[model samples]
Target chain A: MSIAFFAAFFLAWQYSIVWFDIPRYILTPPSVIVTKGWADIDRLLYYTWITGVEVVLGYAVAVILALPLGLAIAFSSILRRTIYPFVVCVEMVPKIAFAPLFISWLGFGLLPKVIIVFLVCFFPIVLNAILAFSSLSEELSRFSVSTGASVWRTFVKVRLPAALPQCFVGFKYAAINATVGAAIAEFIGSDQGLGFYIQIVTGNMRPDLAFAGIFFLTILGLALFGLVTLAERLLIPWHISVRHQSR
Target chain B: MNPLIELTGVQKVFGAGPGALHAFGPVDMKIEKGEFVSLLGPSGCGKSTLMLMIAGLLDATGGRIAIDGRTVVGPQTDIGIMFQDNTLVPWRTVRGNIELQLELRGLSTAAHRASVDELLASVHLEDFQRRYPHELSGGMQQRAAFCQALVHQPATMLLDEPLGKLDAMTREAIRTDLQALWIQRHPTVVFVTHSIEEAIQLSTHVAIITPRPGRVERIISVDLPYPRDFEVKSSPQFIGYVRQAQEIFRGYGVL
Candidate 1:
């Protein structure tokens, strides 16, 4: 159904082009996008890999740092109360504005892009981890304790497992945000990557090439989203999200 | 045996100041090995709280609670607990959830294999061992939870309304299974429930509790024979017992 809808829309859009000359770059036809994409395939792949690496590395770091930090915040009331408000404050501020600052600090290397991705991705992972941990049933907590489970045992065995579904939820959003943050950082400061390609092409008024760059970026985002969804299905098959996906 | 479990002048107070309250009795109780006792009370009577205290999940504000002569400074390894709600981790399969205790103990699979298989067979969950919690019905999940509670073979079983969430027909089915399982293991069971019929049907002795500061109102012995069926509910003795429990509740002005 979705494919059919898109096919019909493309046909209509192509037909309208004969009657009105849409700008060559901004609204490049599907045919031009395909041709340009194939022509620049090698360059596109190279830049895509670079951006993809930054996004993945940043996301991996965020998960590693956030899981333990979030667990600590969730486990200790004192830490949560003292630190969570600061986290919320940082989360509310627009992270895009910090792109230039990161560029200046880290220079034109991959460091700025990776840091930006981490900044954008960490909040959801941390917040969801805290929420999931906080929402664990007290009755179950007591049951674990009475079963002779030590504090550490109770956490890994009971509390952590219980929080997993929620953690995946945050992870899904974080993965997507990580890709976008990386692309934006590339746009702000970089001689390479898909984001820089699009910025330079659009500046040169070659919308078709710019649209092709965007097409790759969209594919990257979709691929990242697909990867997260696939992991969620494999790891948390019992979660309602997976059940809903099967439906 | 000198009481395997003892609670001396145990008091549990909740909150502080004007909102502060006492949930259960300054309980003084003793249970010998292998006794099946029920803590019966109306809703809000704190029967659940008492069970939790005995399970070492909660502390006694007033006096000492000891299990097998050891002070319960914290949660003990020799106790197993089942709550009214199915607390199984939904993401884990039945076998995974059942093996949780053994895993926490860091027991090797080779060592605990026979015990795991026995528990699965005893609970009739061998076929469904790989199934997730959501895949099972309400009754089935509760049965799985029961098996998980007993997988470690603790000396005492503290059940807080384990069957309270099931429908009538499912409740009846599980109650029968529970009785058979109880007879086989014979762990010193302390069950808390608000239902008079359920208490009479399962317990060897019923400890009726008062409303707030839930002290024991009475302890009625159920000397009925074993292998009793659901048909026994229609008997004159069963009716008389139920009525007596109701009267005990009324005497406390609870009903």
Candidate 2:
């Protein structure tokens, strides 16, 4: 049903542009974009690969740092007061504004793009982790105490599993932002990647190719978001959100 | 023989400075071995607070609690505590959740395999062992939690209104399930509940507590026969005990 709806919608979009006598630069139809994308499929896939690497590497770094830091903030008041405010201040700064600084410092290689992605994804994952780790049930906490569970055992068995669903909320958000972050970083300064490709084509009056750039970027974003959703279903099958969706 | 549990002038004050709330206590009581003692009180009367103190999960502001002659300064190891919410780990199946009890205590789940199965069977959850808590109904989830608490065969069970959220039918079934389990294994149980009749049904001794800064209002010796089913609830003697408790509540202007 969803596939058919999209197909019909695209057909209408294709004919409507022609009926309105829209020029190719002003409004390239989906068919033109697809044909142009197919003609440059090799370059498009190559750039997608580059942006994909940036998104994945940056997201991985963010998760590795943010999750534990968030847990620390939740576990100790001292860390929460001392470190969290600084993290919030960093997050408060417009991340795009840091793109030039990153490019200047690290150069326009993969590093800058990856750093931008990390900056974009880090806060959400950590904030959710903080919320997830601390929101334990009172009875469950008492249960841990009564059972003589060591701190490590309780964390592994109870705390980690309970936090997964909420943590995934952050993960999903980070995955989506990762693509946008990479794109924006590339836009500020880069010779490679889909963002640079789209910008160059748009400047050269090839709206069709720009649309093709957008097409691949959207695919990368969807792929990451969909992967996270799938993992969430697999990991926390008993979660209310997951169970409700399956029904 | 020394009592299995003893409390001496136990008090729990919420805060140190002025405007402190005295949640419960200055309570003193002794529970004999293998006795089912219910702490009965109205809602917000601190029955659950008092239970936490005995479990050694919450420290008393004043007084001492000893279990088997050992002072309870930290969390007691030989007890299974259940709360109103089932608290079954949502990530685990019913069987896995039950096994967590033994795993937490650093005991081998393989060694206690027989008892774990027996506990599951007693609760009629043998078939649903593979299912998660979310898939189970309210009664079934509570039953799974009950099994989880008992899998280790703890010497004491601290139950804080474990059936408060269930429907009337579900509550009755679980109450019976609890009675059967207690009869089979005689663990020293400290059950906290707000219902007068429920206390009478399960407890050997009903420790009625007054509201706010709850003190022991009266200790009613039920002396009721075991397998205290619905028939017992309607029995003349059972009716008399309920009336006696109601009359006492009247004295406190609570009824």
Candidate 3:
């Protein structure tokens, strides 16, 4: 960690004028993203927390709602016929175009931002879940049901495990979607968050702080992705990817 | 004792249109308790379809399938089935696969621990109990499948070409193991296979069916006694039976 920090420090110190030509505006240089990242640390921490909460809550809501809905669309021919087309229609609708209307109805509150994030992140989970469920090999399904498994049991025991790999694909996509959704929500409304900070600072032409805000959002997205990857590993250790990694 | 299973006028038809296909026909069959019967037919001859109907995985368009005089409307816990593919869930270990029936019955894990171990030992898979299906060879996977079918101690077992995936040597070895396991469990068994020699080696009765829109062409009883050996394959008795079954197939224009 120290070596990486010094290397970055050494390179930035050697070439600060080349990277950020605005002398007065450059502030403390690459070191400042960390130092001011600490000085405005409270604001940094606050917005980070808000955006983190929004991303997590929005992603959680998407998963909770997506799972059963996805399972239904994947497993039941009737439900798939009834609801899948409508889901696709809603998913294709431009979520960003509704930002002004969301602010108007939801009153520039956290609720609007969360709703936007949910809208953006929900589709992948549902679509991937459906795909995963559909992809289960027929023989496995037959085996479970023939062994006296009820429909629900067959789904839980056989279908769910079979779908986990695809579900992870959905989760990975949702994590990125959550961050972008949170940023867009903060762009339109909200008093605080990395997205809010980015919008406010960028309007006043504080590109350095804007870049910092962008940096934190990237970190948050990466962290969420890392958590999901950890979960995937735990849930399916026998999976080829996990098995190969272990070896 | 009365026969363990009866299939009367069983028929299966697919789709409804001018181009609709008929894969099987109305047929009558019976298997005594503890007997191994083979429904021998080529692919699409409705052998697997017949097995599915008897397993209660599919409904018959015409006729009844009964287990010990009880009509089968849907799958019953007393009947276990295995398909041609090794259907072990890739996520489950060998022991977990075998314990699936017990899990369905909501049998306490503690209650079945010893039995699960016994089945693993019987399939000669005790050492690989913790290994996943993908970790096992094709033969091991099929053995795990067989163990899973018999785990709940079903009164009858339906095997749809269970050893079809293995190589010739593994196929022979598994066939031997399957026969031994069948005797040990003593479940009335119906196995579907295209191999004439397999039918001769494994079955008390071999029922040959004609091609698509299949019907029973002949039912050849192998009066030769049980615990059949490899030598039985080269015997005059076996040769005679094979020739007769072949003639029946020839009559149906299947050979």
Lowest lDDT block of 10, candidate 1 chain A: A141-150
* Share of true Cα-Cα contacts across chains kept by each model: 0.72, 0.91, 0.58
RMSD of each: 2.3, 1.4, 3.5
Provide the DockQ value for model 2.
Answer: 0.82
Error of 1 at A97 (Å): 0.7
Q: What local distance difference test score does each model get?
A: 0.85, 0.91, 0.84
True contacts kept of 3: 0.58
| Model 3 regions lying over 4 Å from their true place | A1-40, A72-79, A132-137, A149-156, A245-247, B247-255
Residue-wise lDDT of candidate 1 within B1-255, one digit each (tens)? 669889898888999789989787788888778888899998888898888778777887888888888878777667788887867888789988888767766656567778888888876788999999988998889889998888888889999999888899998888888888888889999998888988888888888888888998788888776655767877899888899999988888888
How close is chain B to the truth by TM-score, in each candidate? 0.95, 0.97, 0.94
Worst 10 contiguous positions by lDDT, candidate 3 chain B: B100-109
Q: How accurate is candidate 3 locally (lDDT)?
A: 0.84
- Ranked by DockQ from best down, the candidates are 2, 1, 3
The count of residue-pair clashes in candidate 2 stands at 0
Report the lDDT of model 2 for residue B163. 93
**Candidate 3 local lDDT, B89-205, one digit each (tens):** 778888887776677666676887888888888879999999989988999899999988888877788899998878989889889888887777777899999989899899989
TM-score of 1: 0.92
Stretches of candidate 2 exceeding 4 Å from the true structure = none
TM-score of each: 0.92, 0.97, 0.89
